[model samples]
Target: MKKKLVMMLLAACVMVAGCGKTAVSDNFQNSDAKEQEEFQIEVESKIEQEKCFLCGDAEDSLMGYYSKKESIGIVHLNSLYVSETRVRDFDDDGNELFQQGGSSTMVNSFGEGYGSVAIHGNPDRGYTNIDVSVSDKDEVDFELLEDRLCQICLDTLADFYEDQINSGDNENNGCSGYCLIDFQTKELHRLSEPYSGYTMGDYYVKYDIWKEGGGSDWHRISVFIAYLPERVASGN
Candidate 1:
């Protein structure tokens, strides 16, 4: 089951690429101590520029546990919802035509943050694809920040997914559809969209389904977990 999940995720990563959208790349795999330090400095500097972007919605509601000082950004993994499952088609010769099945759930956040998840198909063929993304309504070049932050964000997400799968919490889980992450409230808005409203303090990190395919790209998984330095000392 564990191996199955990994394959599904890796497949999704490839689909994300074919859609003309690029996943953020990192140098953690081959970086030496000096190179690692340089990467850290670059990450930290970007975090400093817009600390609030990485933070949850703290100004809107005061009832939940929100923190802008403890993290530079939060990562959220959306769940996948499969409408068809356990259905297979094949020719008389047993050549499989198509099969439908999926079980990918949303992983809890590592910190206070918010966003959605997306998936294209069932897990039977291991065609689940998920992309964790972000957007700044302020029209700022936040994609650059996303590129630098994805390394840590994916690390956080992989830990959550691995933990869930190992614990058997992933049984019958399908890809999470569009949803919202209220890290401030520690809540997930499933099968929903962001309400109409724009504020400078509002931020978003979206993880959606790019497409479906089998791609053996383990580099995007936990490979960077060991390279992740501590969270930013303080938010900007």
Candidate 2:
């Protein structure tokens, strides 16, 4: 009789221990689910706040690049429909110096102003130089010029990348490229390959403003945006 009583006690203890473990596990799972729910709510709130200034109608709108400035409205990015002008270099003796290249100009209309990007390239030196300039009809300020120039460069680069992806000629072979933009300093940098030292995911815009003259009414801005990918850059 004593042996049976001891056996019953042992069984009861085992059952209690098993139940304790299950209860602990359930508590842990509930805690995890609550944390996840909180995180999801936070993310949704952020997206909702961002929707205020975001452009939802345009297909080419750069929704990823957000600006909180009051002056900036819903920004759009579009492909360049540049007009090509043939350019040929000649020595003093009228001899061609390099292979025939062309200069292309793409002008975009901005708020109360206009911005243009001129690309000069040769077969030997593909896209040797890119000049970004902006001006306003009435009066242009540093803020307007800087913003317009950066936007133009971003649109151009994004258009180029889209072309490469659509052509199935991307040499990166599914590798991704990122652009870093800094509106404060007016710098734009591109990371063509993975792990290029600089943190990925931001496009920087860097440029110098050279006022034609102290009394000049218009602003002539120069933009420098890094283009590192050889395939898309060289038109290969």
Candidate 3:
């Protein structure tokens, strides 16, 4: 069952690229520590800028998420929501937590129809990628799927923000370190790492949207999770 979910996510995420790196000439894998560090700094800077755009709904900004050939937008803070789950943190008074397919689900944010969508990420499935071809004929259902995946991604991001506030790592601007998680095939990924900053346990929620005003055009969505850095180090 877990495998099937991951596969579906992978397929949805890839969109046109089909769940693989987007043929980058400067792959981060070959980048050394210094280069990676510099890249991280760049990513962090971009995240802050993008956050500002989201806060004020700046339509002129260019830092948006993407799939193969579609532009994806980060969920505006106003159009985001979260739910709690039974997964206890065990470190903080045994309170329940929100995990993929566990304690939380999506409950509507935008487009006047998407309400309470649920999708799960395999905890064991570290950084993963998927490849599949998508057609425009299913654009209606495509938006629904993209909205749900993005909602999950935003909720995961909200969790990251909460974690930051709890750990005294608070930032007034925006949050970072988020990527999509795919558990189906243990594939090597680079483009999935949207933000170059030092992100912790997070995943990518990808989609393709018409890069137009208000970000309401329908395309596709890709919501994936990144593999832990340690896992990447060991070449898993």
lDDT of each: 0.27, 0.31, 0.27
Per-residue C-alpha lDDT of model 3 across residues 110-225, encoded as one tens digit per residue: 33433222333232333322221112221122122222233333344444443333334222112222122221121112111122233323334232212224643322223333
The TM-score-based order of candidates, best leading, equals 2, 3, 1
Q: Is candidate 1 or 2 superior in TM-score? A: 2
Better candidate number, 2 or 3, judged by lDDT: 2
lDDT of 1 by residue, 35-106 (tens): 111111112223322222323222333212323121111233221111111122233343445444444444
Q: What value of lDDT does candidate 1 attain over all alpha carbons?
A: 0.27
lDDT (Cα, 0-100) at 24 in candidate 1: 40
The reply for model 1, stretches above 4 Å from the true place, is 1-149, 172-236
The residue-by-residue lDDT of candidate 2 on 28-61, one tens digit each, is 5444442111100000112222232122212333
Q: Candidate 3 lDDT (Cα, whole model)?
A: 0.27
Worst 10 residues of 1 by lDDT: 218-227
- Residue 223, model 2: lDDT of 37
Q: What lDDT score goes with residue 198 in model 2?
A: 42
